[model samples]
Target: MAIMDLSSLNNLNLDAGSIFLLAITICAFLIPVVVILPPVGLQKGDALLQTHTKAGVEGARSNLKNQFSAEEHAPADGKPPRVHSLVVYPVKSCRGIELARSRVLPSGLQFDRLFMFAQLKSPFPVAVDSTDAEKSQHKWEFVTQRQFSRLANVTVDLWLPDEMKLRKQSMRSDEAFLILRFPWKEDGWRGLFATIAAKLGRGRAAEPEIEVLLPVDFPSAAEIKEKGYTFENVKIWKETINALNMENELPDELRRYLGVSNKLALFRVDPEQLREVYRCAPSEEEAGYQPVTGFQDAYPLHLMNLSSVQKFSSEVPKDDDLKELDVLRFRPNIILSGAPAYDEETWKQIRLKPGSSSLYNDVSFHVSCRTVRCKMPNVDQESGLRHPREPDKSLRAQRAVDEGAPLMGCLGMQLTPLFDPSLGEDRAAWIAVGMTIDVEERGNHVYIKQ
Candidate 1:
């Protein structure tokens, strides 16, 4: 080794250039050391101080807190909670259409869960393709996202034709159709290339979305004989009722996309044959009025608090894939904001009052029961793909609130509208997006249905 470093140093002046060079060398040497080292108080093998700690998850356990802590129940701003948005699911298990204003009827928000999918008791070719007389003998059961997650991707839109145009075309005044769209795969090598391109985010293009028009106004059971539809008894939950089978109306392409081209078919609820809500919180017998819904699982209206969803997301592990969960995962008919997290669990009765009192009277709803959640929320509403585990896993860990079903996680609330017999069939009350939700009563909820 040659000793040349000292000789160069003797000729060099301590100028700005030298100072800058020294600073750079010092920074280069220290940066790696500072970055690689652990925090001052932390040591190797010792658990790191997590930004979102397990304390959040532990604190989220409803069992750990009071039934409804008074301090935590009310909104921080002390303002009444207002409707954030309204959603109408024209078809059960399919996507919902958000609405700014919706009419509230004795049944439900108009046209909500008015249609549903059902599969023949036997597989498609055997029962579905059989002759009309033979087809009526086979049983059909309702299907939902709980069984097929891809149903989430089936987009539904209500399309009402212009009145004048309809009159010119010689169509019925009540004629309306539901426009449905879903993703589809093309045939042959083109499909392979398209899939590759989509994955690579390149020039890959997908086939045009498969669109189908579903008749919104179906003939009643009495009129089905003349309309080429079969009025059949279909099973939804445990109740078997008459539903108008619209299998002949739907296109084969849309059915194939659902992998039920032959086996599954569409059905519309028969208003005359609708079942009454059995598992009500106040009990329909005690409430003195029986309310009915077409295809709703339990109650007429399902509500969720946005704050509760946010609070649930906060309980998710920091390293989890989902940073925050979407509110649509729960499939709420009405979303409420301006309230604290998990506040709806304590609400027993509430009134939805619009900004303009003159437009419509305040509509009251008996907060029926806690919405005992299933793994349905695990499906992404946008992608139509199911997460192996996520919000559901976290839900089970933190939000098993309803003791009625300790194993099942609970979020949101089921509601039964206090329908006025005086309004009759023609007059319907309206609820808007900005309506305030007044908590008329608060009490502990008993999960009535599984």
Candidate 2:
């Protein structure tokens, strides 16, 4: 029995050794393939895709403090008023309207960027085949900068089908078309119209052109009444102000008016301060932080001031012909009128009442990050026009791109609560005022007094 057991053990050992050798040989052959092959065909992460950090926020604030201390202390005599303007972009790249009252929501302003036009086909460089048809077929997806930059130019007029009859006009063919104009360059018009035509097919040619319309009719009281429209048109009226005219560009009165642009709806925060409280940069974390609650984008919030717009206008090329300083280029929810130039860097907190609510329910929002300007800022919001030439002739004008440190506007404050009951229960949550702000600047890391 002992000898039989030993023989079985030897046979088992031989079999185990052969199996182990085979496994090693297979692994040796497969290891190099695993190392060389890309994972799921994804490219290497981009270096430009940086992770914003508290350290970066501290550096930004330090530079801002040193450069603008005097301007910050300069008497408030000529400073803009403390009014606020609350603007909402119902459709993503189309025009946004100033709200008399709005609700605060977690994602952003209620009904903000809720509707968008998806191109059924590429509006540019027409595609030759339907093999990649998915690229061209656009659904009415949510609005974002990714779809259109001049989305603020696309205005809409809501109607009950019957009211729309008046604006509908018949052209050459028995077919009537909607007379729609975008505020930005008409570059995409041909493509957009063609796409629309294709979508309608030959069957609807006799019918009036049904364009995607925003609820806003016109900006002026007279225009709104004359048009017999029911949607908000405050932005249209404000743009008609002489201050926004092409020649005058930025107006002095607008500086004063900026404060009341949306006093109850907007807030500004110091990014460094925000990082200290969350223990992480804004984009790196989820949306529970005060800043994320108000400003839905990756950055803290959208910010713009009359002073900064004016500053950009002053640097327009001397030899070039430029249009008015279009504020709509930067789609900011809250437009600040009174803050000092570049003062957003140091701002800590702001207080505002929610729209449609009694004054008793006023809310507070905290400032989180500094808004960085982009090339889109150069587009003319009124005409839907863009610079015709190259980098030298572009609308960026004199704006300089600062890598580590950039100038920003204290547009408005972000809040903790995502929704405000005043706007509506179904509306998205909003960031409000009265929230505390944490600053993370180099030596002065601390919370700002509300």
Candidate 3:
């Protein structure tokens, strides 16, 4: 029987070497597919799942979660909470207006930060005589800290028409105000602060007058007020102007804006205090883990609790003359009103507009992470405006504890909107927060199923 079986095997013409070669060939193709394909599918699946999960979670968390267990479902203070205050900056970096209602686009707020000034130097005779050249040069010049710290103090009224006009307030002489034609003829058009100085032969001069730019066709506040484009408050303008002024002293490579973001779009409010929970481990130490390269920039949304602001205000000294809490220092995108004490950090999700209307036509924003506070908040927004002897200790104390540290009380959310390139400068963006996601906290840096 054994001899017969051996004879049958030999007749089949299959050897151990042949079998092994076939197995190796099969693995070469299949192993890579097995290793690489699932991850791609997992990433796509995770993103989609996260978006839906966040949306559902936002509604539930806000309604169910509260700092005081007894107040979970009850409305705090008998008033509905405000989820976000949309702000738009018409110029790139100047200032912003808090809008009760705003038009949204894929980039962010519509008609926000669309125009910018480019600086150029020229001396053609015809160029010098043309009105266009004069207007172009005026658009380019800006004031910086290097020339005068008070350059930020200067404010201008921007009037848009066939010709743009910049009316500057008098600095040395209160009654002697100056009006300069933006885009001065001698200097090239498109440049912001630089063009203004170059045209007036004050390119080398320290502390030249500040200039403003307006769209040639857009109506003024009076004309647009009836059309629902009325001008509201503009207190945050100085903060951005100060940031730009400080950047001028730094190198060009370090400069984020070359007076381009004159129309400031957003301002935030960050928690003054935070506690560190844990530091992330290296990627190689864990199985199936990849380190996040931009971990430093991890925050997805910034949330400000209205109650927390009130709590801080209660601690102010009786002798101190503190005004409203300045929102510009923190630079948050969304400001939440009527939240329970320290409840923002516990929020897993936040919906911008619930059932009434979509955040932007057919889009919505999801809250994802906790916004961490930075050292920039320490700078007093009203330092130059207030008296020198005034005790500005609250901001200083807040900064001492918050510099380069994470704040625990605030929450952030990741906004996932369908990409639409035609939406122009209305791209949806995220804000900073300090907390780590559970998936990120565990060995799996890659997003995983909750």
Best by lDDT: 1
At residue 267, candidate 1 shows an lDDT of 90
Flag the better candidate by TM-score, 1 or 2.
1
184-227 in candidate 1: lDDT tens per residue?
Answer: 66888866654554433322344335556666775655667766
Lowest summed lDDT window (length 10), candidate 2: 237-246
Q: List candidate 1 stretches off by more than 4 Å.
A: 1-76, 122-138, 161-172, 188-206, 220-223, 281-288, 318-321, 356-358, 424-427
Q: Is candidate 2 or candidate 3 better by TM-score?
A: 2
What's the ranking of the predictions by lDDT, best on top?
Answer: 1, 2, 3
lDDT of 2 by residue, 335-394 (tens): 555455555545444455433333435444445544434345545555444554322233
Q: What local distance difference test score does each model get?
A: 0.73, 0.37, 0.33
Tens-place lDDT digits, model 3, residues 177-271: 11112222223443444444443343234332324322223344464444343222222212211111111212232122223233222111111
TM-scores, each model vs. reference: 0.72, 0.41, 0.35
Cα error, residue 287 of model 2, in Å, equals: 8.2
Positional deviation of residue 379's Cα in model 1 after best superposition, in angstroms = 0.4
Off by over 4 Å in 3: 1-80, 90-93, 111-210, 214-303, 316-323, 354-363, 378-450
Each model's RMSD to truth, in Å? 17.2, 28.7, 30.1
Name the candidate, 2 or 3, with the larger lDDT value.
2
